[model samples]
Target: MTIKVLVADDHAAVRAGIVLILDGAADLEVVGEAADGEQAVAMARELRPDVVVMDIRMPRLDGISATRELAGVTDVLILTTFDIDEYVFGALRAGAAGFLLKNTDADGLVGAVRLVARGDGMISPGVTRKLISAFAAQPAREPSTRDLSVLTAREQEVLACIARGLSNAEIAGELDMAEATTKTHVSRVLGKLGLKSRVQAAIFYSESG
Candidate 1:
């Protein structure tokens, strides 16, 4: 199935480049483009694309706020030049499905869009360590109040792999299970934890420690 996408960035040149890259892929199509956060949200609601490739800083709403508005409406993939902890954490907290740096190659960009479209998640490899560290520095939650005992052993293992930023295929390989099974475990883990995405699952795992 062709994955429809909406590209949103204030820079016309950068937005064009992303559109070009995404349109080059056989399974991906650029349905629309937005020049600012407000426009992004408006276009997103109208077009209802599978994914929205968003920039963090825009004139009106900012990507985080737009992301917050679009939550449950469509998945958002934040592609921006900024890799600061504030943007990273803010984007994830705003319900972005993926966060990637603008420096990402064409293939990486396409892969991130596809991943988010399919309900998986991605974070730029360069910022993954920083993201983990930021999460770790947050105050730990009380173990008794925030129990993970509800997850099965396999589900807990899946959550751990997610916290380590492993893809479903990687988690499957690590656990000696099929990729489909890994996806199942991931879904179960998120459902049991009452989390929205793998990003949140990772945060929960980090704060649990």
Candidate 2:
């Protein structure tokens, strides 16, 4: 299936570059381009693309807010040059399905888009460790016992793996399970916690810790 995508960035060059790369992929099509976040949100609402490749620092709205607006409507894959912890945390909490650095290679970018389009999640491997460290200093909020109680022991282990920024393959290897089984556990955890994406599941686990 061709995954329709919208490219949003403040820089024309960056947008063009991303569009060029995505256009080369047979299964990924560039549906629109936005110079700023407000335009991104509006165009996304209109186009209803399968995914949006977003930049965090735009003129009017910023990608974090734009992602929030597009939540439940279209998946957002955040692609920004900045890897600051705050931006990472903000985008994840705002419901982005994937976070990638602008410097990512063409194959990685395409793979990430496909991942989110297929109802999965990813964070650039380069920043995954940094994400964990940032969460370490964050204060835990009061957790919903009723929500967390629904998880089985193995599902709870899977939640911790996600909170540690491990992907399904990594979690599967670490926990001695099949990758498909791990994905199931991740989905179950999200459903039970009432979270929309794996990023939120990670944040929820960290905040509840």
Candidate 3:
């Protein structure tokens, strides 16, 4: 299936550039564009695209708020000019699939969109050290910590793999489970733990140790 995408950025040139690259992909389509956060939210509801490339800062509404609202409605891959640690931290907190720097090369941008469309998150390796350490510093007493006992043993095993940065396909292979079943398990982990993204779950797992 061709993944339909909504590009939301305040700058006309930026949106056009994204459309140019995305429209070139044979299996991807840009069905809509929004110039601000409010329009991004509205467009997602109206067009129901599979993915939304959101900007962290925009007029009318910031990307975080829009991301919060659009979380389950559509996957959000933050497309922002800021590559600061705080931006990545907040975007992930808002349940964004990942963060993409505006100056990213064409191949990197296209890969990010495709990865998010596949229900996977993308984080740049440049920020990996900061993110891993920041999340590691989170207190164990923090509210998002969940009780792993609630999950079946296999589910707990799958959740741990997710925390360890394994993709659903990798988890399936590691667990000798079907990919479909692996997705179901991953979703159940998120729902049961009140977690938003794998990043959050990873934080909990690392902090719990």
Task: Write down the lDDT of every candidate, Cα atoms only.
Answer: 0.89, 0.88, 0.84
Model 2, 124-195: lDDT tens per residue? 987788877776666766766566788999999999888776778889999999988987888788778877
lDDT of 3 by residue, 1-209 (tens): 89999999899998899999999988889999999999999999999998898887789999989999987788898988887877888889899988888788888988988888776678877667778677567665645434876788888898889888898889999999998898889888888778887777777666555
* TM-scores for all predictions: 0.82, 0.78, 0.92
Ranked candidates (TM-score, high to low): 3, 1, 2
Error of 3 at 95 (Å): 0.3
Q: What is the C-alpha RMSD of each candidate to the true structure, in Å?
A: 2.8, 3.7, 2.1
* Candidate number with the higher TM-score (1 or 3): 3
Which residue runs of candidate 3 sit more than 4 Å off their true CA positions?
136-146
Q: Report how far off residue 153 is in candidate 1 (Å).
A: 7.1
Candidate 1 or 2, higher lDDT? 1
Candidate 1 residue 88 C-alpha distance from true site, Å: 1.2
Candidate 3 lDDT (Cα, 0 to 1): 0.84
Clashing pairs in 2: none
